[model samples]
Target: MYFSRLTFNPLVSHQQLAQTLLQDTYREHQALWQLFDTDPNAARDFLYRQVLEQGRIKYYVLSEREPVDRSGMWLVDVPKPYDPKLVEGQRLFFTLRANPVVTVATAEGKKLRHDVVMNAKKQMGFDALPPADRLPLQQIVQDSCVPWLQARAESNGFSLEPEWVTVDGYQQHESFAKQQKRPVRYSTVDFQGILTVTDPVRFRTALFSGIGKAKAFGCGLLLVKRV
Candidate 1:
């Protein structure tokens, strides 16, 4: 895998255009494929995350091969290979922007949905109680997202240090596909912490495959650094 960063230049266009590139699903998907020289149909191997750092629009991407610089709206750095040798018990610090959701059975049948935190609260019977008896949203999210992440790590070749994990920046995004014209809604949560590599092979797969849904729309990219 190769890693790259693209920073949008507001001087080339309005900030709205840059923001649209980050939010509009179809536009961003098409824009990402432009980084490669091959046909759009063949350029399907990549994961990207859009982030705002120090008031700048930046995107971090991981791809199977080096990317070609093809856009004037943004500046792309030379892509670097991310193929790392792995071993058991290696500790690292990581951050992930993921769409955390759960599958639930509804009247229509099984559906994958967001708000794992809300469901946790409901399981505690908070919805049936008075407002004052309910837990704060932050507390509920912290309680719920940790276990959810832990479950993901168990199969993904990592074990998160419970004491070091922190969850914040919870948000929901609504987008539409150009062809479908129907609204698509998803929620995102940011996770940061230290983790031990438990299964090298599975962990490598997790690194390349990403963590959750909406991977195309800037979610589920796990960015990590050796600690």
Candidate 2:
């Protein structure tokens, strides 16, 4: 596997392209797709997280192959090979932006993935409550999304205490696809904390394969470092 950072080049003079990337998630996905288009029929096999630092747009990407930028708009960092060496009880500081959802069986026996934060709001009748009576958005995010990450950690070969993690940046993204009839929609939550590896093998898999959903639109890349 390889890890790389792609940063927009202000010297490239691509204002329109930058605007499109900033305003349209689907466009950004398509732009990133160009980096890994070794095969026209290849499926997506990478995870990315888009971030803004010092007013510059940047992307952190993990992929099975090195990313090549044919476009001049980005300054692509040299791709570094990644093979995590982990052990049981190893603790690392981590940051993950995930599309956290819970599968629920509908009354009609259909299974649907619902965004945990939105589900919590509905279950608590948040909309019905007056504005003054509503809980702070961050509190609601922490209350709902933390548990979702906790549940994911249990199965992903790591463990985290609620107090050790900070969850926020709840956001819903909506976009239109030219080839699709329905609008695309998803929610993301940011999690940052220290985690202990209970199973190094499993944790390594998670690091490569990602966690949760929406790997295409910059959602499930887990960035970590030694504490």
Candidate 3:
């Protein structure tokens, strides 16, 4: 696998145009698609995360193949081959932006994906509560998102303590696509903390293939480093 960082060229004259293009999620996806536009029929096999620092836009991408800079607008870092050596009982600090959802079956047995945070709010009847009785928003986010990650960790070959992780940045996004009538909708939550590898093999799969959904829209890329 290859890991790469992509950023707008500071020297580019169209800074404002670049910023505008990046603001639209669909446009951003199209721009990034140029890197892997080798096969017209190829399915997406990469995970990315968008980061904003000091008003500058940046993207981190992990893919099965090296990314090429087809557009002159980006300053593409040299793609580095990534193959982390892991061991059972290893601990590492990790950061992830994930689209967390739960599957619920309807009366007719149709399964639907619901945002975990929204689901929690619905289950708690948050909207019906008196203003003074409602829990802090951050508290609700933590309560809902932490367990969602923990449950994923258990099956993904890792373990996390609720107190060790910080969860925030819950946001809902809607982006229009010309090819589709309805807008693409999804929510993102950021998680940062330490995790221990209970099974290296499964952990490696999770790292390479990503965890959770919406991989195409800059979610589910698990970034990790030594503790």
Candidate 4:
């Protein structure tokens, strides 16, 4: 069960973007380096080849030590070049494939979908990036899809890291509200959702419960748990 934000931006080229964005996010991303197995660069190479190729990467944009932008995606055409000497001994570069969970719903309420979208913010090894506003163009891939990636990671019990090519959670986040340019000021994105299980058998049960019963209503991504 993973959530992902989707988008398309025709601007990306700073090859170092991927390394810059995720460098600081390692703890939350590739946390259990030992417990999860392998050394540092083991996981970094995966993301560099997978996510960055599509110009997609995940991050929690911060401001003054507070999270200002919850999470979002940026899509662009340019690519962040892979650099091994920047940090760990991993070599990184761009690719041309899409990651899962990318969508294209307008702010009004629409669902444009795709299999995999380009990611631009990928780099080899690891290192810290610049501040948000000061973030360079190479670091600005238009389609990020961080939410879905993150959600998938949480459900899988493996954190996201540059080491892995395809991250479980890319765009999943703490909000059901429309993706925003920045985080909400007052009220937060309403995460009130339904934890539902649906299969051929469960659909029979859903048939019994009317739509107005609050059991089955919203038509967003449905997280299905086996238990």
Best by lDDT: 3
lDDT by candidate, in order shown:
0.82, 0.87, 0.88, 0.27
**TM-score, one value per model:** 0.89, 0.93, 0.93, 0.19
Worst 10 residues of 1 by lDDT: 35-44
lDDT (C-alpha) at residue 113 in model 3: 97
Candidate 4 local lDDT, 201-220, one digit each (tens): 33322222211111111111
In angstroms, the error of model 1 at 84 is 1.8
How much is 50 displaced in model 2, in angstroms? 0.6
lDDT of 1 by residue, 108-139 (tens): 78675747876787689987989988788888
Instruction: For model 2, give the 10-residue run with minimal summed lDDT.
Output: 14-23
User: In candidate 4, where is summed lDDT lowest over 10 consecutive residues?
Assistant: 210-219
Q: What is the C-alpha lDDT profile of model 2 across 118-227, one tens digit per residue?
A: 88888999999999999998898899988888888877899996788999788999867557778789999889999999989889989998998888778878888998
Clashes of each: 0, 0, 0, 56
Ranking by lDDT: 3, 2, 1, 4
Residue 205, model 2: Cα distance from true site in angstroms:
0.5
Error of 1 at 226 (Å): 1.8
lDDT of 4 at 167: 24
